[model samples]
Target: MRTKPVSDEKSQRKRFLSGNGFVPFILRRLLTSVLLVFGVTFISFSITQLVPGDPVAANLGQSAYSDPKIVAAFKVQFGLDKPVPVQYVKYVSKLLHGDLGISLSSKRPVLDDLKEYFPATLEIALVAVFLALVVGLLLGIISAVTRDRLPDQIIRVFSLTGVSMPAFWTALTAFYLFFFVLGWAPGTGRLAPGADPPPTVTGLYTVDSLIAGDFSTFKQAVAYLLLPAIVLAIYAIGVLTRFTRASMLEILGNDYVRAARAKGLPEITVIRRHVLRPALLSIITVAGVAFSSLLAGSVLVENVFSWPGLGQYAYRAAVGLDLPGIMGVSMVVATVYITMNLIVDILYRVIDPQMRDAS
Candidate 1:
């Protein structure tokens, strides 16, 4: 066959990529995500407006709630004196400029506080999701392999109990047993008393500490992290286990699977190469959902452990009735969720060629 010219090949490649609608599909989703973020921001702002108490009061405290001049200045200072539409316009404008407004409680920028707090949540939530995937997949694989037997029965019941039980109750019980009685983990918070966080290189204590050669802080951070990560992971673990088991069962009985088995391939190789790899499509879907839940913040677990993550920060904002802070947290959460969803949608294209073809 004759070789195509370089310019012709480039033109053909561009045409092929543009013809698929793949790039356009992603761009469309991005546009949709931007619209969704706007909607979420509007809803969050409106809901915060519905919250009783003035932003001035939240900013100045009980002492200044009755001071007219102070309240007026505060309102103007943050543009709260305007009508709701005006305020929303200003808020969105500030957001476009990377300003999340000032935290009424701390008198700091909401964006600054979020940057400080979010990484902590991400660190622990990442650990939780990792643990969930590892443990859940192991149990699921074993259950599928030993289908209808005692192991499967036990795993089913365990998953049921986990899915049924509330995370708060589990967290409290675990805290009492592990921290109070056994004293295995740190009592509360992300660091030991009087211990400064290591240099904030990445704001994740474990990683930052390790990077700075601060093993002591790194170890303490891990210890403080483990209990909460475990508690937060329980629900995800149950869900992943069930999904994995179901998908594995479905895959195990396929004609190709049976043929592979009949070909006398090693059980491990067949399971790893043919069964697990393909069945992972379903697992990845479940994992993305689970990870979203984790990253959304385990409110109860964060509060119980006194972890200074987004969940704890949000809970404090709620209790304090800090409208700006509340709005900031809501926007952060919506952004995280939408971003994760976009990532998962893209992954669907990679995992299944049929999905790309259909798109």
Candidate 2:
């Protein structure tokens, strides 16, 4: 009786310990990300300050200098007169409180500007990422399985073209060929000019349209989204296809794959059951990294399409020397990249039991 009770207690303790281990792992990842965000913000702020130009004068406009008193007051207001270290500290402190400061050019709060634009960018990026994953994975698998056949050759050519083309050039050429020449899609804007803008529930036009049960508006929104999404998908497809092909090739050569073949398993079953899962692990990793680039790369695509998104905002900000806007966009991009990488790290354990055990 005593031995039985002791064994039960020991088993419960082991289970408890095993379950609690993930708590620390999650907490550590979150803590590390917070530190990283601060570090990136500091570096970004420092670099912008060090860049050649007077941010204050630029912010105040050239005409503000007509009055010497106004120029002095403007510098004092923005703290350009303060030591660089002091300014950095103040900027970081404000950032931690969700105040990104005001854009020098637009004279609007950075957070407010981001709030206005980030949703459209995110909607486009999400659609593009989804398409990239589905198409890239399928093409990669087909190409790898088909080996040196026509399908493989075609996919390779597509991937190479995607990789080699610059995004702006691709966007411009795509716009010209598809919109200007073919006239299959709208030339610019998120919707047809006369179409009623849907109510903003989630700030995503597609989702909002669906919620309103307006199929016509939803269809229009989706159509407007396609060109930019396809442009974004071009680069992602190339990257993911290469990774998936490499991973699939390695998995195909694994012992388990050979054993499955030896066991006379159906070819499809062996490929799907023993090969694809392991191959997908690497592909997932690549997809996560690819997602980080989508937001940044959307700049040219957004500009070409006249989509009101963060990319367009960032472009205008850079051209106009909107320091606050630039900083806000950079911070958002950095945060997104860091978050994606962290999610990927966590997913590694989930996808690979070996990784979970090792952790």
Candidate 3:
């Protein structure tokens, strides 16, 4: 039996991405995501309602908390006087109109707060994902190539430690070791003390600095970001390394790979053209998941590093019992998670003919 030619595979991928089914596939995913986001709103709102503190009391002073008129007025102002269901309905209604509600602690709209901090998180997460892909793929390929050997065993142990360690614990350890012991790492925040931030083109200091040709700010931004990004990437790196190893191990045994090797092709060429290409589908999926997880769950890392990202914003909201802010963060996280999965699905249809045919 012969495999389809390379040209045929390319054509199939092209058709899958540009063909009639692509629109419907995207539509289905969008619909599903919208529904999931709606459900998330309900759950987030309900969960915030159960937080063990009074938002009014948290925002107001102890003396103000005893003032019934001020408390009643505060509740009314925030729509906290309404039933949970009614509040949820109103929240969703306002959400559809692009209102994320005012944060009780900050007295600012939650959307504004997210806008202020989200870029920091996005910058760090992107850097971490890039690092994870590079290091994980390299380590994985090495481990698979050196299967059952000392190198593979060492990598396996490293991967296990990376995945098993709690992110906050790793973050704290890294912080102390680098900042206090080694004195090589920049300590916390997006820049050094009194450093003038770059002009806000994208709200990401690294990007904005480059755009403005300010290499000084860019260097400081990267220095501060490095340790935290690495800490954030540890788990993703572990997961990706293990996953890539498994995928490569499976594909390495395929007939095409064996045939390519038998054809007197260079070892690197055979691995690249045959083994790695087939394994990319799995790698892409896991990478998307890892990046999304980094975005949603980097709260402890952000807190440890004092990185003013969405995670830190969420932490503050939760601590202050800022219902609107908590719900806003939840919606953003849930939406991001669902969106990443949808993107992975689209890549599947684009890369894999079997998935396209099934669709």
Per-model TM-score on C-alpha atoms: 0.89, 0.91, 0.90
Model 1 TM-score, 2 decimals: 0.89
Rank the models by TM-score, top first: 2, 3, 1
**Which residue window of length 10 is worst by lDDT in model 3?**
1-10
Cα lDDT tens digits, model 3, 67-103, are: 9999999999999999988998898999999999999
Alpha carbon lDDT of residue 128, candidate 3? 93
**Candidate 1 backbone collisions, by pair:** none
In model 1, the runs with Cα more than 4 Å from the true position are: 1-28, 57-59, 356-359
Best model number under TM-score:
2
User: lDDT at 298 for candidate 3?
Assistant: 85
Q: Put down candidate 1 lDDT per residue, 248-337, tens digits, no spaces.
A: 999998999999999999999999988998788888878888888875447788988889999989888888777778999898889888
Taking the candidates one at a time, how many backbone clashes does each contain?
0, 0, 0
Candidate 3 has an lDDT of 0.89
Question: Candidate 2's residue-wise lDDT over 1-359, tens digit each?
Answer: 12234457778765545543566567778888999988888888877777787666566657877788898887777676788898788888898799999887777899988988998998989898999988898888888898889999999999888878888899999999998899987768888988897998888899999999999999999999999889988899898887788799899999999999999999899888899988878888889988898887899889888999999999988776666788899999999999998888887767788866663
Instruction: Pull out the clashing pairs in model 3.
Output: none
User: Candidate 3 vs. truth: CA RMSD?
Assistant: 6.0
Clash pairs (backbone) in predicted model 2: none
